[model samples]
Target chain A: MDHIEHLEHTESPANMKKQIWNTFYVLLVLTVVDIALYFALLSSHSIYKNILFVFLGLVKAFYIVSVFMHMKFERKFLASIIILPMLFICFLIWLALTEAGYTFDSRLF
Target chain B: MSNTATLSTDNKQTWGGGKSPLSISYGKLMMWVFLLSDAFTFSSLLVAYGFVRFTFTTSLPNAIVKPFSHLSHTFTEEMQKAGLFVTERWPSPELVFNHFPFLHGIHLPLMFVSLMTFILIFSSVTMVLAVEAGHRMAKKEVEKYMLWTIIGGAAFLGCQAWEWTNLITEGASLQNNPFGPTAFAALFFIVTGFHGTHVLSGVILNIVIYINVINGTYEKRGHYEMVEKVGLYWHFVDLVWVFVFTFFYLI
Candidate 1:
């Protein structure tokens, strides 16, 4: 029993507090930018505007996952193991939207 | 038999049976796995929303309405008459979710949801702070931050309830939508409702953990890993909101 150690976890960095606050500011600014862009491109219903918004959302997600969730400090194998599978969502989006376009074309209205 | 004895000596290696390969505890690793699967569930819902939304024409440009202007009592009616809200077109989120609490008819767009986003983000920060405090074994700091996190979560839930009530009063529900196509209201309810349910559970979890902290359970156990585990869950909720805001509101 003495030889068996407690469950292991990665150590927090010394400046973790500062890093947390910095990430907060980054997330805050990115969200503000998202709102600003929403207004700035209000009249343009182009696909590019939607892409830009999604891109910014990904940026915010990165900060949250990397800093707030501590994925950046974790082992690369673990991070990749968790994140790589999410790429399939990109495939799903493309397939669904393409089918949706065909559905849109077929509609009589 | 000799091979078995020799192989046992390699237990400290990457494939070692006695050690975690990822250097993460079983509980934390499972938490990450759960979050990944949860992410997929949310992605599927949002993708369905995108497919349905894509089938409809993009929202018609709005030249008549401006932010902060007077919102007429018949605002939806006016939009319907103006053809801004029609069955063939997807409704712009700004027009649909424009109302704010206690400031009726002011024509605020995306203001309340933005505040909701801010609340969730702020609470996420507090949760991480609590985890940070936990690392230091600072019980008081952990308790304080956990309380703040709980308050933020509760406030966010309150805001969602108000928004839901507002939409319901305006005749938006799963089966009916006065704004535009029925699917618009349906997706809104489903996506945000799902995320709201997650937040509700998160707050409940936070409260439970808060009690355990108050009881000095972690102190007695000689570690605060539980805080870190629940913090992972709290942050995942916030992460889902980021995409929910993007697709449901912004895009």
Candidate 2:
């Protein structure tokens, strides 16, 4: 009986749909912006082109992670579990660059 | 280390049926746990791909022309075979994939991948609807939504198939292809092909679950956590496609 009540309570337009279409629309817009950025990177200056590519990539990834992956709805622990590890990953990348750059200065020179 | 032994008793309690065990169900929580682990798995894959891509050996053969010329060569020789060759070579990825549909000959590799990206994302949308229908005990809605998801999955797979054939026969391949660095063909096959296998499995699995849903199998369990659980798996597949799109195609 209680289970039925909870199921009934869970059923509603607000809960079931919950701005899914809105999210889809936003994702669509982001995709178009991504394509535009792709073109601008190709024809524009090279200095910020790489930066633009990485920046757009990160935004797209963030949207997928937070929305489709449901990290936004999860608990704080879940958020930490998801975001904190990426920090470690970033640290590793930094270490790799440091090591690679050392070879450039010492050996390539 | 602490995350190990996931099937242990503590997890058994929390993962399966811990939301007031008598009140809530175990199957749904298990799905959540399964998804959490899958999240890590996909992250590892995307990260590993990054590691390889950053360190990609630049000494590979003529990686770009190899695929295009391979197709152009086929087109020329098969003019008798093809009856009428366009005579123009298939543009490079830097050219072909980058262009808009009607605006042919434009260099838009990222745009093409974006379309594939939307296909998977739309499928994800349909899948969420399936889960919602399951929650409402709307059997017909569930079936309808599941059918949509199946169609979406099929469409994604079809796109992937065209991609693979274009790569192997008309474009770059292991032995063929005039461009790309070393290991490009091999890595391409391994990574994208593996993801294709996952989507295929998701399609089959969704079909089975849909069958069970309509046949009143999960109805005995008194909830559609089965659908939700599979929904998590399906979403994970879609999520992986997102990164694969960004890295393999866009980058």
Q: Give the number of the best model, judged by TM-score.
A: 1
Q: Mind sharing the TM-score for model 2?
A: 0.70
**lDDT tens digits, residues B136-219, model 1?**
999999999999999999999999999999999999999999999999999999999999999999999999999999999999
The alpha-carbon deviation from the true structure for residue B244 of candidate 2, after best TM-score superposition, in angstroms, is: 1.5
Docking class of 2: incorrect
Interface RMSD of each: 3.0, 6.3
lDDT by residue (tens digit), candidate 2, B1-251:
22223334475743454234222235644555665666566556555555554443222111233212333334324432332212122122343333343543333355556777888889888888887777778888989999999999998898778667655654566554433443445556777787888899999999999899889887777777788678877877876675666556545
Model 1, A3-98: lDDT tens per residue? 346445667789999999999999999999999999999989888999899999999999999998999888778899999999999999999999
What DockQ, on C-alphas, does every prediction get? 0.63, 0.21
Worst 10 residues of 1 chain A by lDDT: A1-10
Q: Write down the lDDT of every candidate, Cα atoms only.
A: 0.92, 0.60
Residue B162 Cα positional deviation in candidate 1, in Å, after optimal superposition? 0.4
Tens-digit per-residue lDDT, A1-109, candidate 2: 3333341121234554765666677767877776666545543435365456566656765665556545555444545644665566566656665564564355335
Q: What is the DockQ score of candidate 1, to 2 decimals? A: 0.63
Least accurate 10 contiguous residues by lDDT in model 2 chain B: B83-92
Clashing pairs in 1: none
